[model samples]
Target: MSSDIAQPTTATGHARQYGDRALQTLLSANRALLRAEQVNALYQEMCRIIVETGGYAMAWIGIARHDPGRSVDAVAHYGDRDGYLRDLRISWADVANGRGPTGTAIRTESVQINHDFECNPRMEPWRERARSHGYRSSLSIPLRDERAVFGALTLYAREPDAFDGAELELLNQLAEDLSHGVRHLRLRQEHAHNARLLRRSLFATIEALTVALEKKDPFTAGHQRRVSRLSARIARELGVSDFDIEGIRIAAQLHDVGMIQVPSELLVKTGPLTPDDYDLIRRHARAGFDILEPIDFPWPVAEMVHQHHERIDGGGYPRGLRGERILLGARIIAVADTAVAMNTAKPYRETPGPDATLQALRDGRGTAYDPAVVDACLHLLRDLREAA
Candidate 1:
C-alpha cells in the first residue's frame, strides 16, 4: 500500500482541515499559557495580541475579589496609554453588579459585547467614561476555571461594531486559555504568601524567647520593648517600608540575646566591670548573631544582630565594620540601642531623660553612628516625648 492515503471527498476533507487548524490554535495557546508564571507579562501579551490581531483600541484585565459577590478590580491594562489613563479610574463603586458589560459577563460567566454603548441599557452608567475616551464599542469576556467565574477581560474599540463574528470567536477562546493561566498564577502567589507567613511566625517565637530572657534580669525587664519601639520609630522617619520596619523591630528585641550567656551577677553589677567580666559582656553581640544564624528568618536577622555593634568611623565591635558596609537596619538598631541604654536606669547609673538622650546621640553623630540615622532618631525621640 502507498504511504500516502488517498484524499477524502470534499466535505470530509474540509471538516478534517478545520479540525486540524483548531487543534493547532489550541496547541499554540497552551504554549503561551506556560509563560503565565509572570501574570503581568502574560496579560500584557494577551492585550497586545488582541489589539494587533482583533482591532481592539484598549484591553484590560479585572480580577474578582475572593468574595464572589463583590465587584472586581482592574489588575492589568494595555492600550493607547493616554486614553487608558483618562478612562481607567473607574472603581468598583462605578460598576454596578450584573449591570455593565464587564459585570454582566462575569455574572453570567460568558462573553458579551456592546456594539453601541449609547443605546445599550446595561452599559449606560459607564457610557460617559467610555465616550470621553473615544470608545464606541466593547467586548467583555469572563475568565473562568472549572469552579466559577474568576474575572473578566474587557476590550474596547474606537469604531462601533469593530468586533465581528470571527473576532468574537477568537477572543472567546483566548479568554478561556487566560482563565486557566490566571487560576494557576493565583495559586502560586497564595503558596508563596503562606510560606512567608510561616517563616515570620517562627521568627516571632525566637523574639519571644529573647524577651523572656531579658525579663529574667529585672533591670532590663522592659529594655527590649523600649528599644524595639525606638527602632521602629526611626525606621518610619527614614521612610522604610512596613515590611522592613517589622523586621527591624523584631531584630531589635533580640539584639541583646547573647547577653543571656553572660552571668546574671555580671549583668546586674552596680560597680564597674572587671577586665574578665567586661570581656564577657562584649561577647554578647557575636553570641547573639550565632544563636540566630541557625533559624530561618524572613529577613536578615542574623546579619542585623552581628552589625548592631559596628560604628560609622570603624571604631565599634567584634569585626570593626565601617560606613555603608554595615546594613542600614543594623545602623538604625545601633542608634536605638544607644538611645534606650542611655535613657533607661541601669544598675550602675541613673536614667537620663529624653532630652539628655537626644543630646548624647547628637554628640556621637558620625563618629559612633550614621549621621542620617542619628538625625532621624533624634527627631523621633522629640516627637515621642511630646506625644507622651
Candidate 2:
C-alpha cells in the first residue's frame, strides 16, 4: 500500500515537471515569432498559435489611434475569412466606450478575463454578441511598450473557464512579446515614410532648379527632360537593372543643375563665347556637386550628376575621370546628354538629324564616350525608329 502511494506521488511530480517544460517551450517560440518586424506577420502567428492551442476561437489586435483623443483602430484580425476581416474595422465609440473587456483592458492597463461571460456584469452588454459568435468566455490583455498602453490582444473561447491561471500567464507573456514587435514595426514604417518624403522633396527641388536654369537659357528648354528619356531608353537597351535605370534617369534630369549658378547673360548670349564665358560654362558641374553634396540621398545621385560631363578618354572637366572609373550611370547620362545636344537646336549649333547624330557618336566612339554604352544607344535608337 505504501509503495502504491509513493508511485502515484512520483508520477504527479514528473507530470508537473513536464508541464513546466512545455510552458517554457511555448514562451520561447512566442518570443521568436514576435521578433519579426512586420505587424501583420506577428499578429497572424500569434492568432494561429492561440487557436491551435485551444486558447481562443478567434483573435484580434487593435492599435490605439495616433491622435491622443481619437478612438483605437483594428489593425489585425484572425479566424475570420478575408472578406470578413476587411469589414472588421471597429471604433471605440461602437463599443460602450471603455466598457467591454477589450476597452476596459486598454483603459485600465490590466487583463479582463471573462470566465463566465453570461454572469459577468462587466460583459453584460457584450454577452449577446459573444454568444452569437459562439464565444462563451474571453480574455483581453493590454499591450504596452515601456512608456504606455498601445493596444490590446483580445482572445475568444467557445467554453466557460477556458483560460485557467496557467493560460492567463502565458497570454501575459505573449502580450509583452507582441508589444515589442508592434513598437519596432511602427518605427520602421515611420522611418520608411520619412525617407520617401525626403526623397520627393529633393527631387522637387532639383526640378525647380532645372526650370530656373531653362528660363535663363531658352535655347536649352526641354533639354533635361529629353536627356532623361533618352538615358532611360539607353539603360533599358543595355539591360541595366531597373534600379540603376531609375538612377540614370534622375541623374540625367539634374545633370546641368550646376548651370543654375552661371550668369544669365552668359547663357543667353547668341554671339561667340569668350574663353572666360567658356570657363564659366565648365564650372557648372562642380556647382551642381556643391549644391547636392549636403542633401541626403539613397544613392550617389549628386556625384553622378557632377560626373555627367566626364569623358571616357580622360578629357572631360571638373574631375577628368576616365573609363570605368566614372560611374556607369554617369557614363550613360554623358552619352544621352551629348546625343541630345547634337540632335537638338542649341545657342551655338543647328539641330542635326537622327542619322547625322548617330554618325557623330560612331565617329567619336572611344575618344569621347563609353564604347559599349554608345553601342547600346545606337541599338536603342534603331529599335525606336522601327517601332515608330
Evaluate model 2: give its lDDT: 0.74
Runs off by more than 4 Å, candidate 1: 1-172, 175-179, 383-388
Predicted structure with the largest TM-score when compared to the true one: 2
lDDT, candidate 2, 103-209, per-residue tens = 66777777877766666776676666666677777778888987998888887766665554455576677787778777888888899898898878977987887
Give the per-residue lDDT of model 1 (tens digit) for 146-184. 788877888887766554444456567778888778778
The 10-residue segment with the lowest total lDDT in model 1: 1-10
What is the lDDT for 375 in model 1?
93
Question: What RMSD does model 2 have?
Answer: 6.9
- C-alpha lDDT of residue 333 in model 2: 91
Please state the error at residue 21 of candidate 1 in Å.
19
In candidate 2, position 293 carries an lDDT of: 78
lDDT of 2 at 366: 94
